[model samples]
Target: MTPPAPNIDPLTTPLERERVLAAYQRACAALEAAQQPNGAWAGEVVWNPMLICQYVICSHIVGREIPEPRKQRIRLSLELQRKRDGGWGMHPDVPPAPGDHDHHPNHDRDPAGLAGAHDSWMFHTVLGYVALRLLGADPNEPLLQDVRAWIHAHGGPYGVPTWGRAWLALLGLYPWSELQPLLPELWLLGDDSPMHPRRLYCHMRLIYLGLSYLYGARTQADASPLVEAIRGELYPEGWDVSRFRATRDQIASTDLYEPIGQSLEWLFAGARALSRAIPAVVRRRALARAWEHIEFEFASTNWVCLSPVNGMLFCLAMWSRDRRDPRLAQALQGLEYWMWEDDSEGLRICGARSDIWDTSFALQALCEGPQIDEAARAVDRASAWLPRAQLRADILGGREHYRESARGGWGFANEHHPWPVSDCTAEALEALLHAEHRGWDHAAARLDLSDKLAAVEFVLLRQNDDGGFGSYEPRRGSMLLARFNPAEMYGNCMLEYSYTECTASCVRGLAVALEALGANMPSELRARVQAGVDAGVQFLLGSQASNGAWPGFWGVNYTYGTFFSVAGLLAAGLDGEHVAVRRAVRHLISAQRDDGGWGERYEGVLESRERPLDADQPSRIVQTAWALLTLQQAAPERGREAIERGLRFLLDQQQPDGTWPHDAAVGVFFNTAVLDYRLYKLVFPTWALSRWLSR
Candidate 1:
């Protein structure tokens, strides 16, 4: 039997029970309306990683790590998803769990077999197995058994995923000839053209850049004994070593996120046919360029690299290039950042760090009122993360390394990416400054920087002359370039766009930076402030939909955006009493279901699905936080009773653990999928409840 989920249904007071039921009904109705075929349960997720992302996040916050054992359990879950027939699917019901392994799957005679029973791709299966294997599961483990059996049950190693083969090539399980070569030799090709790997999505480019160099020379490890053993079991007829060349271009339906353009395909085919010879000097130069990029990513990111997957692969890539490399050594040593541990699972790597991103607002919300106890607790967390997350060493590699100056910036989770994400740095700095204001000592010792204001200065540089903010970096490319997005499953990754949440965070950071600088701020600082305020109002006003909603680019939906945007507007001197503001407030009120609480489906975040919204969908704690914050900002005198009722709903919902239960996802990206901002459950309530206490 499976372990039971924690008790999530909190009991409520009499009045609060009625309120909770009403809100539950409201949100449930909304979700029911938003359902897709089967149980895909997509409310806001766009890139299709919503549920998977959530499982990773919730496990981290609760267990405080992604333990290897937990990862193995995830593998079991994925295995259970496979049908007896031999295929994987998007949802639980899609490719019904395999009914019988003995059943011969005849493709033409069995339409039902093809209906849901077919090998989708080995990529997801490979990822699932890797996660399980990392937990110490051997080749014979039930989960691996199902995966390997399914691979052979479908055909053989030749039926495996292209991406899976590529990863395995690095592991020495497969030869490089099987991969559609992402040649770093292409770096020898000029940069101005669209062929450069740097032109890909930030996430994808981060992975492929390191991979090309590693794959170009066909780097492979001394295969794990377990891996070699599994090679025999993974393929029937004893695994053909050369069949990969013929099947290299095979496309499994599930693996096709976007089709390669005919032009790019022709170029690749043409390259394969060509001699593909480059001058020895050019090869040296290209390898040098690749090394520079690899080192830059390592230095800027403190050898943490972008994601754990890439971070691990890049570690191997660096080792392949130079066996005695110090950068490679640092990456290996620092691998613990991604390695999470728990009692159930000994050790499992995290998707990324949560403590930094989670702890920031945790500190600020705790500081809002005079809850000195909670404030001190949050202070301790921020105190521990701050000094450690700072970049004390100079960067080592990349084009930006040769740029004018180093911006002492921070990443989303620690100093892992050192990429100087403008808002992340601003938010980190603000959190640190708040910690200082709350009387916490800077726990990170010997942390001195000549670049004291480098991060804030970076923020200033990022601010447009008109005064708006964008995520990651400035808006450097065209939005029209989205048409060329090869990752069909994703949207809006080609360039940065100004977002209200980012703008609010940046604006608030500036206010704190001004305070930190004291009267030493240039006279121009005052001018900049006014310019920011003016530009911010215009951005906020223009962004508001005709229906009086501000579509959230990041969070679950409009309610999240409205709360932050309205708070920023009010902070910037916009009067809620104004007719437009009043109408927006009323729209928020009218949209609220009979339930005293508010709940917006993730679809509302991704697609701007405003209502006549749903009732009977239980109101989530995070949504309640957003609504309460909005109500507080709107300061709707007549609506105080309703707002107070919503407060009771939250108070009643708090668990003995001092946390609320996870609800439906509350974040969206690429405007199609939802992500769980699980931290929102804790931080938003802490901030909201603190506001109520102050009241």
Candidate 2:
């Protein structure tokens, strides 16, 4: 017989009850100490190895020596992340523990099978090999040989995705013909055209604008011996430049997350053929237009360029244009903003800063606790930072870069990141409102009523016709646009689509805004807000799965989506007795573990299902907290037992310093890649425990 399961219930005898209170106090103190003087709670944005590799490549392009310490750190990061066969996983270390591999179709027991199960891609492997080589690892190093063998087994250099092919060409390791045509002329299309860059997601459009310039000019770095060495090692059978033209559309199965459709291929083929006949004057004008847009993006975002993917591509475009421009120096300097260094992993690039995102959640968590007054100092400090983080009207208006107005919204990271996201804006508004209602006395520099209304207006502008919200803009195009997705490293990244998470956040935030506005809100504005809330609720209700769960696009699986769904509806004035709320509560109850917590695997989100859990894959503190929060909002009376169990789980997991260890990734993008936002564990769990105790 198996040994009895571990007890997860809180040790709540009269003698042990004090420990919970002490733990809560410790957590509050830790957050207070961690707050930045600027009122932000910026945390590490842990991502894959590509950003580090991009950094090394950027340093090489700019002819700057990476500091000895940074170089060593890069080497160590690659060393720690490299799999047994010398390739890196898509995200880091994604295999299940021994005996925990479940019945997924992708499960494999061999080492290579384990790597594939974790979703290793040739796109990432090429970058890893390039990074190692740039860091001065010998070509004949055993690790390099192993990496080469893996690449060869997968399909060699030609099998790389579009981005990889472009990077290789930039390094002078591959020919330009290896990449499909990225037409800068597409910029000439009218705004009304469905193919306009404005309609694409911010990341896709930004990267495309810059990459098209590089491809159009056929820009490449000066050939060096190292480049020759890369070319030799990548193609052991000896490569011919002529071979690339024939295999432009060829991508390896390992690298292809979403294959370009034959129709898209035909369209691209036609564009390439038409480009040959275009007059030189038209080509020159198109390149100029592309350059102008690229420069505008840099100026707007302070050279950060949205994310590292586009940031580095913009840098490459600048380098290709005028290597000696003073602006290049500033762009290089700004790259440090995304660099994260730790004792174990050295340095890697974060997907984004996500300061506002983490801080908003942390504030909500603090306010939910019974002892708001006890945590007053921490609350005040963080609250003071929120109003300052909102975007001003002076930023880019929609007409110029095909951007939506950012006047009153908030972004994921800091003010320097110009794009305002729907969920982030909603969360920020909610946090600010919470601070005000709780009487945190934010009189020093709080946003006035006008500013608050402007934020509400921003949210209103982003609501889709269907009542949901997209990340950056309202849905300008259809999900079918993904059929032309060129980036095989990710999926569903081609267009902006509404998310259940963003929709929920917006509805809840508007409710708070309306409450704060009260009679002061204009009659028309209030009517608009009420309509949006109703439509949004309907969207959430309609989108709920047959299993009573909502799927999260930005976080792991149903847990993330359901939490926002239940809480948002309740915030919009739906009661616990509502059918949608009742079903959601049941789903949470069923998902609760024997240990009284909740755990969700990243694979579950990738596949949009409840993935089988590995025996060793224990419940996560973050998911447990989310479930607790959801239940409290949806049905407090019925969820009391589960909430207590979740609170106990948090108490048990709290570190001595009042932090939670970085568990598995809680953030996702493109429904495939798992990313870590370090503050999720600390902020969400602490928030849940505080609320549970207060209730």
Candidate 3:
């Protein structure tokens, strides 16, 4: 029933090629102008307002000197992000129309009537309220009072989420017994047990280790007058603390992204009872074991820990274990590595650094447009840095620390970032291989063949049984882990699942690595790599949605998934005329705007739902780049005109300073929270332009 697809050739007339090359030069020049002297291109990682508050509380707790200017910056961020009723939510709003910082005072008098009322979780609200008080805001300040009143309306600290309860208990505002027992003995679970800690997603497992130690030790901060004062403000009418244990399982409605089912609740209750009966010596051994694992994490990442969420919790736990510990001091100092400041948002934490991730893609994209002789210095610097950044050794304490083989894999952030993600590793390998295939002399930069082979092996180990790949390691836990997920503000926090984006990254990486190795590669290793690529290609073919779009795990939605899927298929030798490739090409063309741009809203990705293409939404530079690049890979012959139009859209949108205006969010996590990767605009558009010019 589908009409025969239009026939077209990507080969441009002389005039068209000239226009494409001009755009390519402009884009590359823009990136070069923006590149820093440090040999890295860093971009802002837009995160939630809760990060600002977490930094405030953690700095105060650790006795680190919080500069007055930084304090004011955090205050401004909270004030600007505040809802009409004086509350904060999961994400900040787009900036007030350029240059109009009127601070709209009279928006909504009733905090309950705010537009995103459900978006404000008790966890964030409680932290924000406390952070304000710590910054010397009066208890009776009208804004403070309104936020406090809202908290009570939502069941106060008693109804905070699981992580919030742990924090409040650590602050001495809540009783230790009120928390569900997170005993370290769980680490003793056999590998065959479904509940083994190693089976959890890397982030979740590491967070639990720190949390269980503090909980099992009944650790609480020393009593302070400020803590005592905030306690009164939070629970103003409190009388009997006896019922705290009874309310441990209670969660606020606003926080319920994933509800705890009855089975898990009953299981938790029985666990709590058993925890009370645990022998003191046995508990000591478990807590000691937990502390050692904590030490291993601190050593692995040089105290950056995985993400800021676990980083903050680990800071608190280490302080509890040994206040004078030098590791604790280093952890506090390293926190600044992820701290980002903006005039509008003030201060917040990044989800992770994007140095290697951004640079790898930048180099690979540049190879498509810029000659090695033209971007020589830039390419040499990046290539030199890439070798150093690759994980040359597995993490220390591999078995005891519950880490996977990381040698030659790339991390999401930087070398110091402990987690080696499958997609990040694949992208790193692909970038290096592509650069070499395009005549980059890796030997000139001292990068040897062994380095390339190790990267190939890393990807081979990460492919799942389905031929897809997960973010961190191969899948170890079942989806059934979701039932016990107590972090209600987010979904899919319990385990890592195979992702289309990750699978595609591996396919592309393997294909390029094999090409670069050629006959020089050992026959056995080449055979293994070839088989892996074949399986990955099948996975992509079978995973396509009926509508021809693929769902993305790490990016905004289907557009992101389809972009990677089509690119991987092309790299694996699928022809543009192939039915699957044609279907994908048609699917993307359907979403193109009249202006020849593409825009994908973050709402569908956040809600895990399908969205119709609507011209009503403004065009996004990032999505446009993704769509353009996919078209270039899947159907360049019939896609030249479309690609040209898209190129014009990007050129028109770029700022004179070489950056594109920040578009809609470019990334998402936990299926609900949205974050931004600021450099996506520059890197992807440049990549898209280069692809068109190459054709």
Candidate 4:
């Protein structure tokens, strides 16, 4: 049976206790109200306007017309994300500084006035201008005029980065010959070859799989007046392909996160020369091999591919081969799974769906809160939905296709989305364990013992030799492979290295399952779980920095990493007196803002270190919740005052309707794109407060 909820803290004043309970009630209500009809609590996975731009460009390449209504909505979305400098940025506008309530007002004003914001990538600006034009916006319109001037001032379209160049070249607005090559012949490399595409990270390799195929075919849309007009507009100076081709290596300063190094340049030159030397017969064979992989990817994910970025690329590749292929239509329809439409952002395709990820976390939060009885029906629905969302079988011929086994795991989005991630599986297993331990009424919906063991085995398989876990697969390529990284807009994307968050989640999940399974577990599985937990703990201990913070690869910064690390350690049976736990507690204590909350800037992600946000900067609800959750587990007695203050901050920040503000980006990836998960504000804080009350 589940343990009883802890008594209300004796030290809390009567008035404070009343406030806490009221706030808790409201937050629970808000969460319950937000549940979707399918029993999931999916938030919009907000990203940049680049997705909209790509969608428009892709529709043009495939000869699909955008309906007038959808086009207007896309235009509105572009207008909303435009910066004060009359350019589109790589991510949404950063929230304003403290005491600036109207910073992001509900009007045309650019709140941050961040004209030169780091997020103002030249690639996004170029895509935005072209997308607006394709959507039928007048060139002489004031917004278009301002955007055009911004483009010219930023060195025009020639300065766009490698991927941007590829997109433009595909649309016949730029020259393909001058762009850096993505050789499909690389796919012909043996499985054992170190440089094989299969050795790269799953997302990176899948994207290039489509890109290499298109590059080999020299795929370009048929020339149209729209393409010609956009071409002239992009290069206002002139459309001299040879003159602009010289600037192929010249990326805009704003968009260069990882410069193409000297070694990569040599490799590119060699690849260009090799492309010319390869026999025509060999080239045809390589393209056929590349197409085999593309077809396998489409079959694996039911034609969704991996992400919208690659999803678009694969659609273009399919059209180039055989426009009448029925699978091309299926692949195009699968892209709709990632789309999110709303009055505010209009019709935008998300980078990925968060249904399973969001629902798993939300379930755990509800189970932890004192109001579980009120949320019982919601819990029952979510609990029932989670098991259905689990990937029940491995992808057939997964090894041949370079896929890790997905059986007993959950993908980030939903079951049909076949790329199951380590952290997502761990978190989902932990949530189910919480529900089962509570003896929830949905008995028939519960996963069987075999299912639970399969999940544990799945996570166990993801553990690297170093004892840490990677996101999708074990580390396949060397860190030295990073030198060959071609995606300038991203970082650490060439290989799947072990991440602190993934390791911590796996540790905690395995620990909980070990206890929950009790005598029903097999002895062999138990031994493996114990060994995995011990090694994972050692990895966490070894990875902690001198200041006791761990770098967060998935979330905003150190606060996220430290929170998961501390929780994992405690769950692995470490006490508050453990040196790692104490150091982590102290780190959180030092980072606490004067207002009693916590905040971290996205810039810290770029620095690959924990640079605490300035004290005067606005604190974030999600970070504050993370801090409170960590402090309560790791230093409840030593950091009592800090805990109480954090609780108060959360309580005060709660709105009359029960939710806290999503003040900043909480999720991050590739050290660049910052993500705003909309449900984060409601989920984390409610979890924190519930734990505080229970404690």
Task: Name the candidate, 2 or 4, with the larger TM-score value.
Answer: 4
* Arranged by TM-score, best first: 4, 2, 3, 1
Q: Where does the lowest 10-residue lDDT sum fall in candidate 4?
A: 95-104
Over 525-585, each residue of candidate 2 has an lDDT whose tens digit, in order, gives 9999999999999999999998898988888778999989888898899999999989999
Best by lDDT: 4
TM-scores vs. true structure, each candidate: 0.72, 0.93, 0.91, 0.96
For candidate 3, list the clashing residue pairs, or say none: 8-637, 10-637
Candidate 4: tens digits of C-alpha lDDT, residues 457-537: 999989999999998899998788999888888898999988999999999999999988988989999999999999999
* Winning model by TM-score: 4
The residue pairs found clashing in candidate 2 are none
Candidate 3 global lDDT = 0.76
Instruction: Residues 117-187, candidate 1: write the lDDT tens digits.
Output: 34344554554454345345687756567766766654554544444566666555567765665667766
The candidates, ranked best first by lDDT, are 4, 2, 3, 1
Model 4 off-target regions past 4 Å?
1-4, 95-119
**Shift of residue 364 alpha carbon in model 1, Å:** 1.8
lDDT against the true structure, per candidate, is 0.56, 0.79, 0.76, 0.84
lDDT of 3 by residue, 539-561 (tens): 99998988888887788788899
How well does candidate 3 score on lDDT at residue 180?
73
